[model samples]
Target chain A: MYDAGKIISGIIIFFILVSFPIWISAASGTIGDVPELNLPADEEQCVEDAEWMRANHMDLLIDWRETVVREGVRVYTASDGKEYNMSLTDTCLDCHSPKAEFCDQCHDYVAAVPNCWSCHVDPGGS
Target chain B: MNALYAFFAVALLMLVAFFGVWGLGWNTLFAVMIPYAALAIFIIGLIYRVVKWARAPVPFHIPTTCGQQKSLPWIKSDRIESPSSTMGVVARMAMEILLFRSLFRNDKVQLEDKKRVTFQGNRVLWLGGLVFHWSLLIILFRHSRLFMQPVPDFMIFVRDIDGILQGLIPAVFITDIAILMALTYLFLRRVVFPQVRYISLPSDYFALFLLLGVVILGVLVKTAWKVDIEGVKVLAMGMFTFNPVVPEGIGPAFYIHIFLASVLLAYFPFSKLMHGPGIFLSPTRNLINNSRAVRHINPWDYPVKVHTYEEWEDEFREAIRGVGLPLEKE
Candidate 1:
């Protein structure tokens, strides 16, 4: 007779690996409450739409870094015909000042390290 | 003819990637939506294929053995090759998976001077295959840095080792070159060898060409057109977290690379590329060679009605008496 034990165990292992995200999410319970960003109280609008910013803020910052540092271009024109300074500290931090409360919230939830603070100083440094 | 079709198919895919991202500027579709869809398909399709294979009952113990079976106590058994026991089977599978033992032993027959035939060890294909697979694995592992935050130390170590020949400004990884060269060799082998070319189907060529396209695009991304690294990480992280944000400022080249990769993923299970997992499920490779030691009973075997010799004799007793023949019943 064929050994059924090994086959069953293999199937179990396959399920465990494949359904890892499900069990992990169930165990962590953080899937329901993805961390929310603390918006600035004074600022009314950003360079782009909120959804666009949420998706592509890092890319915008990266482009800003290259233009400002490499090409020495300081002004950035948004798709909405609005012009803004291309400085992370001067432009972005002016609005999203508290890095820990605002940036770290979503970043920690997603486990993404932008590595921006390594060079640039945090405005709300503890 | 099949090869030409496959070549055109691969060209079409490249064209799709090029036009989809560069011409149409559909970065979100190429980067986020397609990848997510492909991943879902890959996972589900792989699981379905595996389950379908597993459910099929292998009633016979038909293990292909290359060495002598365990029979006489005096004779030495080739445990790794024949694999009569469970441990032997495990060892055999390990060797098969890790070293590609069967491929390593590949022999080629050549007709010399139109009279003499000579068998030569064909290690080139084995070497190409081994290097291609290993390099691919390492490259995939190294890419984990893009997916994971605070990239693991082991991954870093692997990256360092892979890029040990650090003369180039961006630092060239050994696997990058190895995979390209190995893929080229494999492709060339298919084209150059008449026998291989004769047997090669469209799917075979398509898989190879697609993989080559993916590797070339990846290399171009790393070397020629640099994209926003942090943005890439952000995008990868978003995907992992189920938030899937398409990052801006990443070059169209990156979009093309990702689209090609996504297509490969989506096509993986349905194509001949499924041999990666199918190798494990192969009864010839996985089964133990213990037919001599134990009788293999088919699980589906059931009893059936049959006429016995005694019953036949009893029915024919009257005819036998009439013919003056001896009967045990009478």
Candidate 2:
């Protein structure tokens, strides 16, 4: 059998579930103390500084000479945890030092006009 | 129990937040402090895990390889099965991790009509896993669009290519569909198959449930609700720079999505999900096959002074005479 009744009930539940975001958005202002995302619809959203990212503070730097048995080169990908070292030169930002050299070169290769380097650094090897 | 625990933890947090907001009207605490706290936990937890993993020193060269040993030409051998060369090992690891080649050919056995039967070509996991990982990679790539300022050309190109359909509103992307299907396949496979379910635990189920939750909620907020996309981007950008501000017009649903994502981040390095980084760190994967070329003395083995045979003979000379045994140089 098609089971129209069961399917219909499911559809009804689905709509209510789907409407959750709408409900929350609508309730933003009404519910006392709810943080209203009632952003002025006209507010031209400006690209703000990447505020969420906190600088990694740990001295994760590896002593290259000792670990990798090299004079200076140290950082290996974490996969070589035992025998390898992590160095700053391997940081993602080193090559993509500037947008033109590091970020834009490859991004432009694929034809991407990046805004990331404007605000954030490259995936510099940590 | 894992699902139940995860669900209850989520529900409890929601209820606490709801009440806190309603009762105290602590907008700043809810909107600002909690996110900062979560981010702190996330960073600390991630660092702790990485540091712990790094600090663990592997004392031996134990790279898991599959290829021919660099032995004598007369010593006939299968190269890929037991690799003893760098090139051979690299090829094997690459195939195993990137393509999941071994898993694709992996077999599962089950009883059929009282016969020990092996099912061949059972690649649901390998295929599902490949889809999930590949799709996730593309999705993460696509998300880079938000963090950029002028927006890089390649990202724009990818954006355009992803929306090549050119017909859907909000520009439906290939990765979105692919990730959805991938996660669905993974989840369904776990639930539908008896063999899989038999070995499945709450953690496995939780991984699927959590991913599904994120995907479902993401689709809900993105597609149907007509969310303020610009507002979300502002919040994301602001957060990335450490000036974490709750942008206006961003819905609570966004918080739930972001919150769940943050939870996943905090859980990542600790969870088996960390196998991404863990796989590479594994001594079995990174160690070079140099046993034949170089002697691997276990660095920790203490050297003990050996007693010479002359010293032993001297001590046992009297005992030997008592037993009428022959003596040397006597």
Candidate 3:
């Protein structure tokens, strides 16, 4: 308390900066309703398990791209004993079409910018 | 031996968190309660320590000056090195904090064969410290995506720039690699150099090992185990928003990472890590070198009762005249 004013001001600044996440969340609005993805109504099962797909979808997609473009192997075998064409636009986006509803929700929520859209176009409508 | 002790301490912590979550299934305790407790402790302890330091009166102008001070009108002064005014002090502090100006002037003295000695410029510590801190700042900023409701654009920009390599699956951040490399250099510098090794304590090794464990666990969870990031974010956001919920499918590595981070926060105020704030309060660096121009009265100085020469003469005047010593006072 010897230099009360300066010390108090410094502590205040440190407090505000360290608790920035809380202040930012309060200012932005609610606790943020978890992003709701519109699952495809027609399909009950995806190429892989939901948990696996949630985490490793990028790896799967990248593998498909490499296999199809470089190795010219056009078929993929899912772990559940199912075969499908190794194509992003044809097979993956075919089911999860109109990327905004399916892809953008979670991607935007996590602020992940997967460069999948750079080469492949999003099928406009389901 | 000290390094081994520190390493085992961190290993024990990692195992505790691992078992606390994976074995006993106390996800809520490891995830929510401990983190909240650690954050509260961090905030309160930091304020208390800083206030305690603030109460200690600096009774002297003790800035350690290395360059020419402000004196006569004709002589040029090194304003930043030997700061005499508030503006000069501010500029000097800025340079110290941002660029580590003093550390940049480090010199290493080495005995050349058996008798001769040589001095060489040594900037490795400064470079390592700067890289580590800057990368840590960037990583912390990037983590806002998990806690913030609507992630800011600038944070995303920083993440994108760090994750620029397109070939990797879960994009690799440059800061992740940079921080690990910088930490290795710092740790090795402490261990390999005989002089530094003599001065290094177990607490120093403990902090370094703890951070290493946290970062390595994070990288493993992200790339190898590939935990559900959405679930991780849910947990992070829940803690920040005060609506704590233990999310499912998050791996044990993630839990260990969070727990170690909490321990670090709780330990910060009591450890050398407090240097983060202590640097600002150091009298040697923060005080201005203006004792000549400005009188710095000690805060503890108090008035004293003293008998003056006139008063002493008046008290003993009659006694002196009676003894025929002096008869000036009629």
Candidate 4:
């Protein structure tokens, strides 16, 4: 190579950058981890299916807040023909108590800081 | 025809990815194996191409100069244009790579009234190219959160800043919108402009279409499909650590996004996308304009046996004496 030193150095730099995730994972001493949500043992079913809720919970909550606070509508008819009151504190958090254990599990894992905590309080204190 | 070919090719890739995972349920193949293979190919191919380029010798100081060259000490020289030293060359290259200084000076010629010709300054190409590159860079940085275990504070900070307008359920990133708009402008220019269309090839269209597919699919997966974020991070982290576990419940949209991204990586070193690295090796941009100030010796030069003037004079000494020619030795 004409400029072997410069070319090799450039390749080294590029390799390091492209494989940043690999080195980072190695340094952190963990391959991968899934957020462990503490589900209630006694409860048989949530308001909706786990899969749908996993993906669309934020949208559902946002819609619920608009319906309850702005439009003064309180009843939420789930897809399975079950109806429940649309209240974050009373309906959702009543079961998934202790924000740090349930909500914060996934939220902290994904680095999502929801503004829900600013207004609502955790029923099961940390 | 070129555009259609490129579009269909990308569509076919998407369909292959979708069917491969959704229909056949080859989760490991699409999610883990393909990504790893593609990343390896990308790295190896890039290094090979760079080495191949470096092997070819640049025998001349061929810097493309636009401004005044460094001549007399009194004459002010444009360092970033007609670079005369190493520092000046570095500055020139930095501007070329970062801001695309040369493209900023792009001009379009138009025939006026079928008689007069007018050259107009065009900044649209420069603007579109700049926007696309910068947006792509930011998007890549934001994606690092999926790969990192603890998710670095800086990455989160960058993501938060990008998602400041949080009116939507899932905050929209400004880069996503910018990249889409910039890509649209770039693609439209190639199709709409007669001059550009005439020179357009399938590879050019293919690159644009592939990138467009990746971006659109990425946006769809993030917003519409709403794949399990934890599952994706696990999969991403798995790939990095070589553990290679295919996480469940990540939608087909996510699979296709990853597959398309893998295709992009594998195709990178071979395509015009190599321009990402090739730009650094460009002689016109990287070389110093110091032909007058310093001598440049060709590395390929070799020692050769040659007859000198003195030897020729000695060999012709008898002939010179017979012909009555003057000889210094005598």
Choose the strongest candidate by TM-score.
3
Which of candidates 1 and 2 reaches a greater TM-score?
Answer: 1
Worst 10 residues of 1 chain B by lDDT: B163-172
1 or 4: which has the higher lDDT?
4
> Which order, best to worst by lDDT?
4, 3, 1, 2
State residue A70's C-alpha deviation in candidate 2, in Å: 69
Model 1: per-residue Cα lDDT over B74-156, one tens digit each? 99998979987989889888888888999988876768887788766468888899999999999987776566545556776
Task: In model 1, state the lDDT of residue A24.
Answer: 52
CA lDDT, candidate 1, residue B146: 65
DockQ score, prediction 4: 0.55
1 against 2, candidate with superior lDDT: 1
- Writing each residue's lDDT as its tens digit, candidate 3 over B29-142 gives 999999999999999999999998888888777889978999997899988889878888889888888888888778767787887787563677888888898888898898
Least well predicted 10-residue stretch by lDDT in candidate 4 chain B: B162-171
Go through the candidates in order and give the C-alpha RMSD of each one to the true structure.
Answer: 8.4, 22.4, 4.7, 4.3
| Each prediction's DockQ against the real complex | 0.09, 0.02, 0.59, 0.55
Which window of 10 residues has the lowest lDDT sum in candidate 1 chain A? Answer: A26-35
DockQ of 3: 0.59
Q: Which lDDT tens digits does candidate 2 get at residues B272-323?
A: 7867655645666555566768766554567799997788889998998889
lDDT value, residue A78 of candidate 1 = 88
